[model samples]
Target: MAGGRIVVGVDGSAPSLKALKWAAGQAALTGDSLETVISWEYPASWATLMPGVPPEFDPERLAKQILKQAVDQALTPEVAATVTRTVVGGNAAQALIDQAKGASLLVVGDRGYSGFKAAVLGSVSSHVAQHAPCPVVVVRGETGDDEDA
Candidate 1:
Protein backbone atom coordinates (compact mmCIF):
# COMPACT_ATOMS: atom_id res chain seq x y z
CA MET A 1 0.00 0.00 0.00
CA ALA A 2 2.89 2.34 -0.56
CA GLY A 3 1.82 5.79 -1.67
CA GLY A 4 -1.78 4.97 -0.91
CA ARG A 5 -4.15 6.49 1.65
CA ILE A 6 -5.73 5.11 4.81
CA VAL A 7 -8.94 6.81 5.93
CA VAL A 8 -10.11 6.67 9.51
CA GLY A 9 -13.13 8.09 11.34
CA VAL A 10 -12.84 9.96 14.63
CA ASP A 11 -15.86 10.87 16.78
CA GLY A 12 -14.20 11.74 20.09
CA SER A 13 -15.25 8.44 21.57
CA ALA A 14 -12.83 6.09 23.28
CA PRO A 15 -13.16 3.44 20.59
CA SER A 16 -12.84 6.02 17.83
CA LEU A 17 -9.64 7.38 19.36
CA LYS A 18 -8.36 3.81 19.43
CA ALA A 19 -9.18 3.42 15.77
CA LEU A 20 -7.33 6.62 14.98
CA LYS A 21 -4.22 5.32 16.72
CA TRP A 22 -4.52 1.94 15.03
CA ALA A 23 -5.02 3.56 11.65
CA ALA A 24 -2.02 5.79 12.15
CA GLY A 25 0.12 2.80 13.06
CA GLN A 26 -1.13 0.85 10.08
CA ALA A 27 -0.53 3.78 7.80
CA ALA A 28 3.04 4.03 9.05
CA LEU A 29 3.62 0.31 8.51
CA THR A 30 2.12 0.35 5.02
CA GLY A 31 3.60 3.66 3.91
CA ASP A 32 0.16 5.10 3.37
CA SER A 33 -0.80 8.66 4.15
CA LEU A 34 -3.39 9.07 6.87
CA GLU A 35 -6.69 10.93 6.49
CA THR A 36 -8.80 11.42 9.60
CA VAL A 37 -12.46 12.24 9.14
CA ILE A 38 -15.29 13.43 11.37
CA SER A 39 -18.89 14.28 10.61
CA TRP A 40 -21.65 16.44 12.14
CA GLU A 41 -25.40 16.58 11.67
CA TYR A 42 -28.07 18.51 13.50
CA PRO A 43 -30.52 16.15 15.06
CA ALA A 44 -33.72 15.61 13.08
CA SER A 45 -35.70 16.95 16.03
CA TRP A 46 -33.43 19.87 16.77
CA ALA A 47 -36.27 22.37 16.77
CA THR A 48 -38.15 20.46 19.40
CA LEU A 49 -35.25 19.01 21.32
CA MET A 50 -33.44 22.29 21.53
CA PRO A 51 -35.30 25.34 20.34
CA GLY A 52 -32.33 27.63 20.07
CA VAL A 53 -28.71 27.23 19.08
CA PRO A 54 -26.33 29.99 20.08
CA PRO A 55 -25.46 32.09 17.04
CA GLU A 56 -21.78 31.49 17.69
CA PHE A 57 -22.11 27.74 18.05
CA ASP A 58 -20.54 25.95 15.14
CA PRO A 59 -20.86 22.23 14.69
CA GLU A 60 -18.23 22.05 11.98
CA ARG A 61 -15.69 23.79 14.12
CA LEU A 62 -16.46 21.47 16.99
CA ALA A 63 -16.11 18.49 14.74
CA LYS A 64 -12.76 19.73 13.47
CA GLN A 65 -11.59 20.28 17.01
CA ILE A 66 -12.55 16.73 17.96
CA LEU A 67 -10.81 15.27 14.94
CA LYS A 68 -7.66 17.29 15.50
CA GLN A 69 -7.59 16.55 19.20
CA ALA A 70 -8.10 12.84 18.61
CA VAL A 71 -5.28 12.68 16.09
CA ASP A 72 -3.04 14.73 18.35
CA GLN A 73 -3.77 12.55 21.36
CA ALA A 74 -3.46 9.27 19.48
CA LEU A 75 -0.41 9.87 17.32
CA THR A 76 3.02 11.35 17.86
CA PRO A 77 3.68 14.91 16.78
CA GLU A 78 5.51 13.71 13.69
CA VAL A 79 2.74 11.38 12.64
CA ALA A 80 -0.03 13.81 13.54
CA ALA A 81 1.56 16.48 11.39
CA THR A 82 1.33 14.14 8.41
CA VAL A 83 -2.39 13.50 8.79
CA THR A 84 -5.08 15.10 6.60
CA ARG A 85 -8.10 16.10 8.66
CA THR A 86 -11.59 16.28 7.19
CA VAL A 87 -14.87 17.41 8.69
CA VAL A 88 -18.07 16.62 6.82
CA GLY A 89 -21.68 17.67 7.41
CA GLY A 90 -23.56 14.42 7.11
CA ASN A 91 -23.78 10.91 8.45
CA ALA A 92 -20.49 9.64 9.84
CA ALA A 93 -20.55 6.33 7.96
CA GLN A 94 -21.28 7.91 4.61
CA ALA A 95 -18.64 10.57 5.19
CA LEU A 96 -15.97 7.97 5.89
CA ILE A 97 -17.04 5.84 2.98
CA ASP A 98 -16.93 8.80 0.63
CA GLN A 99 -13.51 9.88 1.91
CA ALA A 100 -12.23 6.34 1.51
CA LYS A 101 -12.74 6.32 -2.23
CA GLY A 102 -9.53 5.11 -3.91
CA ALA A 103 -8.06 4.49 -0.50
CA SER A 104 -6.28 1.29 0.48
CA LEU A 105 -8.16 0.97 3.75
CA LEU A 106 -10.95 2.47 5.82
CA VAL A 107 -10.82 2.29 9.59
CA VAL A 108 -13.50 2.99 12.24
CA GLY A 109 -14.41 2.10 15.78
CA ASP A 110 -17.24 -0.02 17.19
CA ARG A 111 -19.26 1.20 20.15
CA GLY A 112 -20.26 -2.38 20.92
CA TYR A 113 -23.93 -2.04 20.11
CA SER A 114 -25.43 -5.51 20.07
CA GLY A 115 -28.48 -7.68 19.59
CA PHE A 116 -31.71 -5.70 19.49
CA LYS A 117 -30.11 -2.26 19.69
CA ALA A 118 -27.65 -3.05 16.94
CA ALA A 119 -30.35 -4.54 14.80
CA VAL A 120 -32.69 -1.63 15.40
CA LEU A 121 -30.12 1.14 15.16
CA GLY A 122 -27.37 0.28 12.73
CA SER A 123 -23.90 1.41 13.71
CA VAL A 124 -21.56 3.52 11.61
CA SER A 125 -18.78 0.95 11.62
CA SER A 126 -21.12 -1.82 10.50
CA HIS A 127 -22.65 0.31 7.76
CA VAL A 128 -19.27 1.39 6.43
CA ALA A 129 -17.85 -2.11 6.72
CA GLN A 130 -20.62 -3.18 4.40
CA HIS A 131 -20.43 -0.20 2.07
CA ALA A 132 -17.00 1.43 2.12
CA PRO A 133 -14.99 1.53 -1.10
CA CYS A 134 -12.04 -0.24 0.49
CA PRO A 135 -11.23 -2.73 3.20
CA VAL A 136 -12.63 -1.67 6.58
CA VAL A 137 -11.14 -2.26 10.02
CA VAL A 138 -13.35 -1.68 13.04
CA VAL A 139 -11.41 -1.24 16.27
CA ARG A 140 -13.58 -2.98 18.87
CA GLY A 141 -12.30 -1.61 22.17
CA GLU A 142 -10.98 1.52 23.84
CA THR A 143 -7.25 2.39 23.72
CA GLY A 144 -7.32 3.86 27.25
CA ASP A 145 -5.29 6.75 25.87
CA ASP A 146 -7.91 9.37 26.81
CA GLU A 147 -9.95 8.86 29.92
CA ASP A 148 -12.29 11.61 28.77
CA ALA A 149 -12.85 10.05 25.34
Candidate 2:
Protein backbone atom coordinates (compact mmCIF):
# COMPACT_ATOMS: atom_id res chain seq x y z
CA MET A 1 0.00 0.00 0.00
CA ALA A 2 1.04 3.62 -0.48
CA GLY A 3 2.46 5.50 2.49
CA GLY A 4 0.00 8.39 2.47
CA ARG A 5 -3.74 8.87 2.42
CA ILE A 6 -5.50 9.46 -0.90
CA VAL A 7 -8.44 11.84 -0.78
CA VAL A 8 -10.95 12.20 -3.57
CA GLY A 9 -13.84 14.64 -3.99
CA VAL A 10 -16.95 13.15 -5.50
CA ASP A 11 -20.06 15.03 -6.64
CA GLY A 12 -22.01 12.33 -8.55
CA SER A 13 -20.87 13.63 -11.93
CA ALA A 14 -19.47 11.49 -14.74
CA PRO A 15 -16.03 13.01 -14.26
CA SER A 16 -16.30 12.42 -10.54
CA LEU A 17 -17.18 8.77 -11.12
CA LYS A 18 -14.07 8.50 -13.27
CA ALA A 19 -11.99 10.15 -10.60
CA LEU A 20 -13.34 7.76 -7.98
CA LYS A 21 -12.35 4.80 -10.10
CA TRP A 22 -8.90 6.26 -10.63
CA ALA A 23 -8.48 7.02 -6.95
CA ALA A 24 -9.57 3.52 -5.99
CA GLY A 25 -7.04 2.01 -8.33
CA GLN A 26 -4.30 4.22 -6.92
CA ALA A 27 -5.26 3.41 -3.35
CA ALA A 28 -5.35 -0.30 -4.11
CA LEU A 29 -1.99 -0.17 -5.77
CA THR A 30 -0.28 1.84 -3.06
CA GLY A 31 -2.11 0.21 -0.13
CA ASP A 32 -3.04 3.71 0.98
CA SER A 33 -6.32 4.40 2.71
CA LEU A 34 -8.90 6.19 0.59
CA GLU A 35 -11.06 9.03 1.85
CA THR A 36 -14.01 9.96 -0.33
CA VAL A 37 -15.43 13.40 0.42
CA ILE A 38 -18.70 14.86 -0.81
CA SER A 39 -19.69 18.38 0.14
CA TRP A 40 -23.26 19.69 -0.05
CA GLU A 41 -25.12 22.89 0.66
CA TYR A 42 -28.72 23.09 1.74
CA PRO A 43 -31.15 24.29 -0.90
CA ALA A 44 -32.15 27.92 -0.47
CA SER A 45 -35.66 28.39 0.77
CA TRP A 46 -37.97 31.29 -0.03
CA ALA A 47 -40.44 30.26 2.60
CA THR A 48 -41.29 32.63 5.44
CA LEU A 49 -38.42 33.07 7.88
CA MET A 50 -38.92 31.00 11.01
CA PRO A 51 -38.05 32.48 14.38
CA GLY A 52 -35.96 29.45 15.35
CA VAL A 53 -33.96 28.67 12.25
CA PRO A 54 -30.82 26.70 12.94
CA PRO A 55 -27.52 28.53 12.48
CA GLU A 56 -26.19 25.92 10.08
CA PHE A 57 -28.17 23.17 8.47
CA ASP A 58 -26.54 19.75 8.44
CA PRO A 59 -25.88 18.78 4.85
CA GLU A 60 -23.79 15.86 6.01
CA ARG A 61 -26.65 13.42 5.77
CA LEU A 62 -27.47 14.50 2.25
CA ALA A 63 -23.83 14.41 1.26
CA LYS A 64 -23.54 10.92 2.68
CA GLN A 65 -26.54 9.74 0.71
CA ILE A 66 -25.19 11.17 -2.52
CA LEU A 67 -21.72 9.77 -1.91
CA LYS A 68 -23.04 6.34 -1.10
CA GLN A 69 -25.23 6.28 -4.16
CA ALA A 70 -22.37 7.41 -6.39
CA VAL A 71 -19.99 4.86 -4.99
CA ASP A 72 -22.50 2.08 -5.29
CA GLN A 73 -23.15 2.97 -8.88
CA ALA A 74 -19.49 3.47 -9.88
CA LEU A 75 -17.36 0.92 -8.09
CA THR A 76 -17.28 -2.82 -7.94
CA PRO A 77 -18.13 -4.32 -4.56
CA GLU A 78 -14.51 -5.05 -3.71
CA VAL A 79 -13.24 -1.62 -4.70
CA ALA A 80 -16.03 0.18 -2.86
CA ALA A 81 -15.11 -1.60 0.37
CA THR A 82 -11.88 0.34 0.72
CA VAL A 83 -13.27 3.86 0.77
CA THR A 84 -14.14 6.08 3.75
CA ARG A 85 -16.60 8.96 3.31
CA THR A 86 -16.90 12.46 4.77
CA VAL A 87 -19.29 15.39 4.32
CA VAL A 88 -18.76 19.06 5.08
CA GLY A 89 -20.48 22.38 4.54
CA GLY A 90 -19.21 25.45 2.61
CA ASN A 91 -17.81 25.62 -0.89
CA ALA A 92 -16.59 22.40 -2.46
CA ALA A 93 -13.20 23.86 -3.32
CA GLN A 94 -12.51 24.93 0.23
CA ALA A 95 -13.69 21.64 1.65
CA LEU A 96 -11.35 19.69 -0.61
CA ILE A 97 -8.47 22.00 0.20
CA ASP A 98 -9.01 21.46 3.92
CA GLN A 99 -9.11 17.73 3.43
CA ALA A 100 -5.94 17.86 1.33
CA LYS A 101 -3.95 19.31 4.20
CA GLY A 102 -3.52 15.84 5.71
CA ALA A 103 -3.49 13.85 2.53
CA SER A 104 -0.75 12.75 0.14
CA LEU A 105 -2.86 13.28 -2.93
CA LEU A 106 -6.16 14.92 -3.83
CA VAL A 107 -8.21 13.82 -6.80
CA VAL A 108 -11.13 15.62 -8.43
CA GLY A 109 -13.17 15.64 -11.60
CA ASP A 110 -12.36 18.10 -14.39
CA ARG A 111 -15.91 19.47 -14.54
CA GLY A 112 -18.93 19.29 -12.28
CA TYR A 113 -22.28 21.01 -11.62
CA SER A 114 -20.66 24.40 -11.14
CA GLY A 115 -19.71 25.17 -14.68
CA PHE A 116 -20.82 27.41 -17.50
CA LYS A 117 -22.12 25.63 -20.57
CA ALA A 118 -18.82 25.96 -22.41
CA ALA A 119 -16.48 25.64 -19.44
CA VAL A 120 -13.56 23.28 -19.72
CA LEU A 121 -13.20 22.84 -15.98
CA GLY A 122 -15.65 23.35 -13.16
CA SER A 123 -15.06 26.21 -10.77
CA VAL A 124 -14.32 23.99 -7.79
CA SER A 125 -11.93 21.77 -9.71
CA SER A 126 -10.07 24.73 -11.12
CA HIS A 127 -9.84 26.39 -7.73
CA VAL A 128 -8.66 23.25 -5.94
CA ALA A 129 -6.02 22.61 -8.57
CA GLN A 130 -4.64 26.09 -8.02
CA HIS A 131 -4.77 26.03 -4.22
CA ALA A 132 -4.85 22.53 -2.75
CA PRO A 133 -1.97 21.64 -0.43
CA CYS A 134 -1.41 18.21 -1.90
CA PRO A 135 -0.93 17.08 -5.45
CA VAL A 136 -4.16 17.33 -7.44
CA VAL A 137 -5.41 15.15 -10.24
CA VAL A 138 -8.27 16.30 -12.43
CA VAL A 139 -9.96 13.42 -14.19
CA ARG A 140 -11.24 14.31 -17.61
CA GLY A 141 -13.82 12.57 -19.75
CA GLU A 142 -12.56 9.57 -21.69
CA THR A 143 -12.00 10.35 -25.29
CA GLY A 144 -9.90 8.98 -28.11
CA ASP A 145 -6.39 10.40 -28.15
CA ASP A 146 -6.89 11.79 -31.61
CA GLU A 147 -10.09 13.60 -30.70
CA ASP A 148 -8.20 16.61 -29.45
CA ALA A 149 -5.87 16.74 -32.43
Candidate 3:
Protein backbone atom coordinates (compact mmCIF):
# COMPACT_ATOMS: atom_id res chain seq x y z
CA MET A 1 0.00 0.00 0.00
CA ALA A 2 1.11 3.54 -0.75
CA GLY A 3 -0.31 7.02 -0.63
CA GLY A 4 -2.37 8.21 -3.57
CA ARG A 5 -2.59 4.72 -5.01
CA ILE A 6 -5.67 2.99 -6.36
CA VAL A 7 -5.58 -0.80 -6.33
CA VAL A 8 -7.41 -3.06 -8.71
CA GLY A 9 -7.47 -6.84 -8.70
CA VAL A 10 -7.26 -8.52 -12.11
CA ASP A 11 -7.63 -12.17 -13.11
CA GLY A 12 -8.04 -11.89 -16.90
CA SER A 13 -11.81 -12.42 -16.65
CA ALA A 14 -14.15 -10.24 -18.70
CA PRO A 15 -15.44 -8.56 -15.57
CA SER A 16 -11.90 -7.96 -14.43
CA LEU A 17 -10.99 -6.39 -17.76
CA LYS A 18 -14.00 -4.15 -17.47
CA ALA A 19 -12.99 -3.27 -13.95
CA LEU A 20 -9.50 -2.43 -15.11
CA LYS A 21 -10.87 -0.11 -17.77
CA TRP A 22 -13.13 1.53 -15.21
CA ALA A 23 -10.32 1.95 -12.75
CA ALA A 24 -7.99 3.32 -15.40
CA GLY A 25 -10.56 5.93 -16.34
CA GLN A 26 -10.84 6.96 -12.74
CA ALA A 27 -7.09 7.08 -12.29
CA ALA A 28 -6.75 9.33 -15.31
CA LEU A 29 -9.30 11.73 -13.88
CA THR A 30 -8.09 11.68 -10.28
CA GLY A 31 -4.33 11.71 -10.95
CA ASP A 32 -3.85 8.78 -8.62
CA SER A 33 -1.39 6.08 -9.55
CA LEU A 34 -2.86 2.72 -10.40
CA GLU A 35 -1.46 -0.57 -9.21
CA THR A 36 -2.67 -3.71 -10.91
CA VAL A 37 -2.26 -6.77 -8.76
CA ILE A 38 -2.67 -10.41 -9.68
CA SER A 39 -2.17 -13.01 -6.98
CA TRP A 40 -1.37 -16.68 -7.35
CA GLU A 41 -0.93 -19.83 -5.26
CA TYR A 42 0.63 -23.17 -6.11
CA PRO A 43 -1.46 -25.91 -4.59
CA ALA A 44 -0.03 -27.40 -1.40
CA SER A 45 -1.15 -30.80 -2.67
CA TRP A 46 1.61 -30.63 -5.27
CA ALA A 47 4.31 -30.53 -2.59
CA THR A 48 3.64 -34.03 -1.30
CA LEU A 49 3.68 -35.54 -4.77
CA MET A 50 6.67 -33.71 -6.21
CA PRO A 51 10.29 -34.45 -5.42
CA GLY A 52 11.45 -30.91 -6.13
CA VAL A 53 10.40 -27.67 -7.68
CA PRO A 54 10.40 -28.01 -11.44
CA PRO A 55 12.95 -25.88 -13.26
CA GLU A 56 10.29 -24.93 -15.74
CA PHE A 57 7.66 -24.09 -13.14
CA ASP A 58 7.89 -20.52 -11.97
CA PRO A 59 4.74 -19.36 -10.25
CA GLU A 60 5.80 -15.75 -9.82
CA ARG A 61 6.78 -15.44 -13.45
CA LEU A 62 3.50 -16.94 -14.52
CA ALA A 63 1.65 -14.53 -12.27
CA LYS A 64 3.42 -11.56 -13.87
CA GLN A 65 2.67 -12.88 -17.32
CA ILE A 66 -0.99 -13.18 -16.46
CA LEU A 67 -0.99 -9.66 -15.04
CA LYS A 68 0.70 -8.33 -18.15
CA GLN A 69 -1.76 -10.07 -20.42
CA ALA A 70 -4.70 -8.75 -18.49
CA VAL A 71 -3.38 -5.20 -18.59
CA ASP A 72 -2.65 -5.36 -22.28
CA GLN A 73 -6.11 -6.67 -23.00
CA ALA A 74 -8.06 -4.31 -20.75
CA LEU A 75 -6.33 -0.99 -21.11
CA THR A 76 -5.36 1.41 -23.83
CA PRO A 77 -1.67 2.06 -24.31
CA GLU A 78 -1.89 5.39 -22.54
CA VAL A 79 -3.78 3.95 -19.60
CA ALA A 80 -1.59 0.89 -19.30
CA ALA A 81 1.57 2.96 -19.46
CA THR A 82 0.83 4.69 -16.17
CA VAL A 83 0.10 1.56 -14.22
CA THR A 84 2.44 -0.29 -11.86
CA ARG A 85 2.26 -4.05 -11.83
CA THR A 86 2.34 -6.20 -8.72
CA VAL A 87 2.40 -9.97 -8.50
CA VAL A 88 2.09 -11.77 -5.20
CA GLY A 89 1.93 -15.37 -4.05
CA GLY A 90 -1.02 -15.58 -1.69
CA ASN A 91 -4.76 -15.06 -1.34
CA ALA A 92 -6.17 -12.38 -3.65
CA ALA A 93 -8.54 -10.93 -1.06
CA GLN A 94 -5.92 -10.50 1.65
CA ALA A 95 -3.46 -9.12 -0.86
CA LEU A 96 -5.98 -6.58 -2.08
CA ILE A 97 -6.94 -5.64 1.47
CA ASP A 98 -3.33 -5.04 2.40
CA GLN A 99 -2.70 -3.11 -0.82
CA ALA A 100 -5.68 -0.88 -0.10
CA LYS A 101 -4.59 0.16 3.39
CA GLY A 102 -2.70 3.08 1.94
CA ALA A 103 -4.76 3.47 -1.19
CA SER A 104 -7.48 5.94 -2.06
CA LEU A 105 -9.74 3.15 -3.28
CA LEU A 106 -10.00 -0.54 -4.09
CA VAL A 107 -11.69 -1.65 -7.30
CA VAL A 108 -12.54 -5.19 -8.36
CA GLY A 109 -14.83 -6.99 -10.76
CA ASP A 110 -18.24 -8.37 -9.77
CA ARG A 111 -16.72 -11.82 -10.22
CA GLY A 112 -13.58 -13.51 -11.54
CA TYR A 113 -12.29 -16.66 -13.21
CA SER A 114 -13.83 -19.23 -10.88
CA GLY A 115 -16.81 -21.45 -10.29
CA PHE A 116 -20.19 -20.16 -9.09
CA LYS A 117 -20.52 -17.77 -11.98
CA ALA A 118 -24.13 -17.13 -11.00
CA ALA A 119 -23.11 -15.79 -7.60
CA VAL A 120 -23.59 -12.03 -7.46
CA LEU A 121 -20.20 -11.50 -5.92
CA GLY A 122 -17.19 -13.72 -6.34
CA SER A 123 -15.29 -14.71 -3.19
CA VAL A 124 -12.26 -12.46 -3.77
CA SER A 125 -14.30 -9.39 -4.59
CA SER A 126 -16.67 -10.05 -1.73
CA HIS A 127 -13.85 -10.35 0.78
CA VAL A 128 -12.10 -7.22 -0.47
CA ALA A 129 -15.30 -5.22 -0.40
CA GLN A 130 -15.98 -6.24 3.18
CA HIS A 131 -12.44 -5.83 4.49
CA ALA A 132 -10.49 -3.34 2.39
CA PRO A 133 -9.23 -0.31 4.33
CA CYS A 134 -10.41 1.96 1.56
CA PRO A 135 -13.75 2.24 -0.17
CA VAL A 136 -14.40 -0.51 -2.70
CA VAL A 137 -15.89 -0.40 -6.17
CA VAL A 138 -17.14 -3.56 -7.87
CA VAL A 139 -17.32 -2.88 -11.59
CA ARG A 140 -19.95 -4.82 -13.52
CA GLY A 141 -20.16 -4.79 -17.30
CA GLU A 142 -23.04 -3.76 -19.59
CA THR A 143 -23.99 -0.17 -20.25
CA GLY A 144 -27.70 -0.77 -20.80
CA ASP A 145 -30.51 -3.29 -20.68
CA ASP A 146 -29.84 -4.94 -24.03
CA GLU A 147 -26.16 -5.48 -23.30
CA ASP A 148 -26.61 -7.16 -19.93
CA ALA A 149 -26.83 -10.91 -19.84
Better-scoring candidate (TM-score), 2 or 3: 3
How would you encode candidate 1's per-residue C-alpha lDDT over 91-115 as one tens digit per residue? 7778888999999999988862222
User: Could you give candidate 3's per-residue lDDT for residues 102-146 as a string of tens digits?
Assistant: 899899997887533566457888888788898999987665783
lDDT of 2: 0.82
Model 1 superposed RMSD (Cα): 4.3
Order of candidate numbers by lDDT, starting with the best: 3, 1, 2
Most TM-score-accurate candidate: 1
Candidate 1 worst ten-residue window by lDDT: 112-121
The candidate that achieves the highest lDDT relative to the unseen native structure: 3
Q: What is candidate 1's local distance difference test score?
A: 0.83
Residue 8 in candidate 2, Cα distance off native in Å: 0.5
Model 1 lDDT at residue 61: 93
Candidate 3 regions exceeding 4 Å error are 1-3, 47-55, 115-121, 142-149
